[model samples]
Target: MILDFGDGFFLRQATVADHAALAMICLKTGDAGKDATGREDDPDLLGLVYTIPYQVLEPDLAFIVDGPAGACGYLLGAADTNSFNARLVSQWYPDLEARVADPGPDSSRWRGSDWLRHKIHHPDFAVPQALAAYPSHGHIDLLPQARGKGIGRQAMAFLEQRLAASGSTGLCLEVMPQNVHALNFYRTAGFKVLQDVGLPNRCIYVAKQLGFAPGVAG
Candidate 1:
């Protein structure tokens, strides 16, 4: 199913060729659901950590929303969280560890590239309960220009179908408590709060089963 935007948008499987453009979109919408063109100097921080690796490891699982201008949004992640996280730290993190610059002493209040760099060294996960119950996860980012186009919902539904087909029983994701819009979207998408988390970061862990109620849509 092609989830198009306006009259000219369409969806396609993300390829290596789209890496740079996808990373740019990740940066453009990195600031808590807003445009952050000047928010950080490094455009690869978020994508390198959260996005690029997923595409690199599981190319077919990644998809992009394309428009006349360029890539406007994308859904990138793995089907199995436990395995994906293990591979990420053991295999993927090592590659990024050498390149990601260290965060300063006051990195606690940092955002954008600085905070992203910090996270590279200190990987975070959802709460234990959530992790045990929902073993698949990923993230989605849509540029401001892509919002209100129903692309988010379409992208999510497509992702759910893909995940369910992959044999994932459930999916999970970590969201910052402050992103109210995201929280609402997840709720509408059939995700429920699994629990509150405060380990590596203060956030709420949300989840959805794959084949039933409180589940990802068809």
Candidate 2:
């Protein structure tokens, strides 16, 4: 275990065997930090797109949040966004595109998990120039049972330390503009909103500088 939160909650390195649990957690907290089970038809698609790839492609930075019941959350990161995006395009997306049919470009006719299906086929691997300074990126999600117990704070600190130890000078995360709680949490965690980035209307980028000492191995 990487961390023991006590009361039967802990953090551990995630493995491929935990894919199902990760998918369920992704679906449960999929809708802008709310449960999206009712809205998604193919519930696992969100995890396939967002969470699973981290464990498969960057295992060192992927971890699971386990409670008494089971895996309830995840912390995932990419130390280098450019390399990670390239790997996703070359090694990950082709297989996924073949497995999932495109839902087409028309949003009006889309339903259920159609949006995610479209994203799979037409994946965007671009990293905005504004985010170039923060070349590393991360994601963290916790179920309600794991929140309010200082888990999120500890998890973020853990991720930051990992990235810093790996020589990452900066780290960034994209949050939905509507998720006020997340935005606030990030701000409280020392992340600042990046201004003047030409991102889509849906995204808000928050970033922080990492203190990487020389000669440290991740």
Candidate 3:
């Protein structure tokens, strides 16, 4: 299912068998140096981000970067607001009151999109409003080896096409303002920031409209 985006790279839906490669990709992307909690290590929070989506949903919302060796990147989407996993946040973060648990909250912290977005984006036992307009949205990541290969651009385009064919009106995602490089990348790809999420990392929600029916084949 590799999509030749030209320029020597392609995007494809990830499979269950890709767990190992995807795990490695997560390590590289989530790597945040070393730590005792064993969470704020490399490749950072990407592992937590990717794994939750993959474990909760499947084929409908996961894409990957394929090159000469294996998966170099991945994009994940979770459209269903009532998903069981969405309700399991408490289980993962039982110490919700421990916001100040870390001495350096400024660093080694992951942003949870503010409560409002969570309320709207992650409703209880009901689909989100955005799903009617956007349906599915998630993050994209590319390994260092696959950087500058146009895989990210091709991936966004491909997902937009696929989601549109599946009846999605648009796609949404967020990026840290501090990540100027990533902000520029999504901007270049036609995504615009919609609002500030006000998380620890200062994330901003961005979206791209697909003005057509979804799942249109390329």
- Model 2 stretches astray by more than 4 angstroms: 212-218
What value does the lDDT take at residue 164 in candidate 3?
73
Query: Which candidate has the highest lDDT of all?
Result: 2
Best by TM-score: 2
lDDT of 1 by residue, 1-218 (tens): 35654667778888888888777887787777666668887877667776777778888788888877788888876887777778888888887879977786596667667777777778764336535556678788887767877888888888888898888877777787878999999999888876445334566777787865354343
In order of TM-score, best first, we have 2, 1, 3
Q: To one decimal, what is the Cα RMSD in angstroms of model 2 from the true structure?
A: 3.3
Query: Any runs in candidate 1 off by more than 4 Å, and if so which?
Result: 1-6, 104-112, 125-127, 196-201, 212-218
Ranking by lDDT: 2, 1, 3
Give the per-residue lDDT of model 2 (tens digit) for 8-86.
9999999999999889999999999999999999988999999999999999999999999899899999999999999
Output the better candidate (1/2) by lDDT. 2
Clash counts per candidate, in order, are 0, 0, 19
**Residues 1-218 of candidate 3: C-alpha lDDT, one tens digit per residue:** 75786655677777777766666676665522111124433232344334544643556677777877767788766553335345445443333323323323243334432332233233233433433455566667777778887777877787777777766667777576666778788889988766433322345666777765456311
Candidate 2: 10-residue stretch with minimal lDDT: 209-218
